[model samples]
Target: MPKLIVVAGLLLALTACGKESTPTPPPASQTTQAGSGPVDVNVPVEMRPVLSVDPPAQTPAPAAPDVLTGKDGSTYRVGPSIGDFGRFENVGVEQVDGRWVLNIELPDDTAAIFATWTAENVGKQLAIVVDGELVSAPEIASAITGGALQIAGSFTQKEIRELERAITGK
Candidate 1:
């Protein structure tokens, strides 16, 4: 009947409208798998000392100084590359409490050096330098005698991998 034909047409139209469109492919740059290979990032990191006031250094200070500005119009400095990451033995990323953490392990001798440095610098902050940029300046609670340290940040999996690759260079 004509009524049956109209109902069929309506059903057909509804079904057509319910269909989902094909998804567009992601950009080529974003399709890369994390930790698959070297990621081209300019943010190379280095450990630097933190200072409340700029040191009495000569003009054109170190090629790069990690400067952190606080919301209260305060400025802090971290530099001289005290414990460069180049001496690290291994770096890995892990998830803890649904958050990403970067674990850095150093050799025995390097560990001792860090322990001594941290012990002496207790109650101070160590600037996490990344490509002349200060990412974070965490205070030293206790001496890091274990030679292994963990950096906890609310980073994504991709970011964690990128940081691991950046620091390890592997």
Candidate 2:
């Protein structure tokens, strides 16, 4: 009797596993509403990586302002690009007393040349350029005779680091 009972239970479980159900469709009115766009069907579909349909076009960025163009159409650039003007011996960011500044060091001969150049071009603006960008253009009030020059831009530590890298080419 117990064996017959177990066989009956097994037959019921096998019949339950064979049962199948059809998905119910939405009502016709909800699917075909007037003046509405096509219904957005939420179905699982295979995803794919997007690819460019057209050929890619590369565009160059605008050049930065480097040369100081004078009213007479004359242009001036620093270092070997121009005249025998002095090279920047050392460029770094340092804290003097309690303030941070970008320091530039020039040799004695170059310092003399810069002093003379500034003194001759007093009242004119000299553009301090970096990586073709005109960072600053201050009027030459007097000659910068001292070989050491400090640039204070009120920049933070990060900005100072970037500026140092830009100026030093490091």
Candidate 3:
């Protein structure tokens, strides 16, 4: 039996079958550009806790620079702390179900941390930061105990490789 899981915030759909879960792309409203952005591409990937989403704050806080304003004019805020499992052990793109998804492998210890964070923060969103930009903000639907995860969004082949290089530092 396949167990379906959702990640990537508003732009993720992944299906798990026999321990292999591949992601599916979201609708047109939300797409991810994990690499190409105006910000410097040298920054490492981080998962910061989302402070707010849509309907921008009445008076933006100090972390205004960290605000992520989408093309649709929706805005969101993320915590300053780099809250995440840890640096990924492996990051690469793969094709599944006719869509491209970013596959991330975490170390056992980091995976444990991720599991805990997810468990505690269910319903909260995480800012998937890649290359110093908010590439995705996926809500935590449930605890992800598995050592791996997939981020589904639109990315060109160049963007995918660029993201991998930035994340892997290779």
Score every model by TM-score.
0.55, 0.45, 0.59
**Candidate lDDT (C-alpha), each:** 0.49, 0.37, 0.55
Question: Each candidate: how many clashes?
Answer: 0, 0, 2
In the predicted model 2, the residue pairs found to clash are none
On a 0 to 100 scale, what is the lDDT of residue 111 in model 1? 70
Q: Score residue 143 of candidate 1 by CA lDDT.
A: 69
Model 2 regions lying over 4 Å from their true place:
1-86
User: Candidate 3 on 1-170: residue-level lDDT in tens?
Assistant: 22233443332342221112344454342334343222222455677778876654565434456776532344767787544433555565665555555667676777777778877887677666665556556666667776566654455556656645655545
Q: Could you give candidate 2's per-residue lDDT for residues 1-170 as a string of tens digits?
A: 00000011011100110111221221112121122111121221111111111122253323323333322233334222212322455555555444345555665766676667655654444544444443334444345566655444345657656655544445
Task: State the displacement of the C-alpha of residue 142, model 2, in Å, after optimal TM-score superposition.
Answer: 1.8
**CA lDDT of 132 in candidate 3?**
57
Off by over 4 Å in 1: 1-45, 53-75
Could you say which candidate leads in TM-score?
3
Distance from true position, residue 118, model 2, in Å?
1.1
- lDDT string for model 1 (1-170, tens) is 00000011011100110111222221112222222222233444576767754434434334434555432233556557775554555565656556565566676766777778777885566665665554455666556676766554446788667656655555
